[model samples]
Target: MRRSVRSPYTIDLGQLHFSLQYNNWPIGYVESTNDNITIHSGENAIQFFGELQSISSESYNALSTVIQNFLTGQTSKIEVLAGPNATSYPLLAAGIVGLSLNVHMPPFSEQLIASLIFKSMSLIPSTNTRNVMLSASITIKINSPLGQQSPLNIQMMNMSVFLLYENDSVGMLSVYQAPVKQL
Candidate 1:
């Protein structure tokens, strides 16, 4: 007689870390909506909502200048990076769609809380899996007192949800496996 054997399988999820930079230097802490990322195959696209908090006054001023320029029809560029790949994209204030800035008064430790919404600027499909990574760099240029240019950069990194193509048999199987909901 022979005994049957069973093996367990595990899936490893991917993670992404995002931050803002100026001249290659990191700025304040960046926070996003969800801490854990999980993409369902059913989603066509995903949007990231986040806030940059506790930034220095100088950094805040620089960012404000960038936004001012963007609102005036000037294009700001943003740099995005993932692993070994990096790309730059132009951001228009009009494209931002929604924005809110809150400044703290003195004696309370000055801080700036900025709400930002970023849409799907572009997409890159993964060659190995159904996953995709979206990366871009945003550049903001401001004029100095002497009429020189000062540039501030914001970097973004995010991953797309797993693709569930309608023609994919595996995706169909997973869909059927989901528990039915009774109304």
Candidate 2:
């Protein structure tokens, strides 16, 4: 008679500790099928946006907040105030518009996404991680080729973002830059 036997080797921590999170924005960007569009090939995007006028639009603030929170896995305690116009707050302002962090969680990996920059400077974060996702709303302050009159407004409002981060034991800065790949 042959009997089935069991050989067991198990990791016994009894009480395991881990965090589970699933988050995303419903009213987010819808991707355009066109891949021929060029993105951020200009001189300096960060600086470029700075020169442009800013709006008191909560859209930009919300977008920035989501990005910072998602990347850092933390909540922002301050209440961000919106202005009457887009140019009210400088592109770069005195206060920290979004939350920042320094994380050092192990098992680090990065995912790169291709996205386009809109005239209004909002970015639609790509969908990747199971927990966190971001959506952007753009408001153009200037009347130009990329404004509402121009159909390019929608196309310009696209962006790609890195979407995974584990809280480091000794959190200093939340891992933000996933790095842009070079051709």
* Top-scoring candidate (TM-score): 1
What is the alpha-carbon lDDT for the whole of candidate 2?
A: 0.28
User: How high is the CA lDDT of each candidate model?
Assistant: 0.34, 0.28
**Root-mean-square deviation (CA) per prediction:** 28.8, 27.6
lDDT of 1 by residue, 63-107 (tens): 565455444545434322222111121132233323322222112
Candidate 2, which segments miss by more than 4 Å at Cα?
1-28, 34-55, 74-183
Instruction: Locate the minimum summed-lDDT window of 10 residues in model 2.
Output: 44-53
In candidate 1, stretches whose alpha carbon ends up further than 4 angstroms from where it belongs are 1-17, 25-32, 40-44, 80-183
- Cα displacement (Å) at residue 170, model 1: 76
After TM-score superposition, what is the CA distance of residue 68 in candidate 1 from its true location, in Å?
A: 1.4
Which candidate wins on lDDT? 1
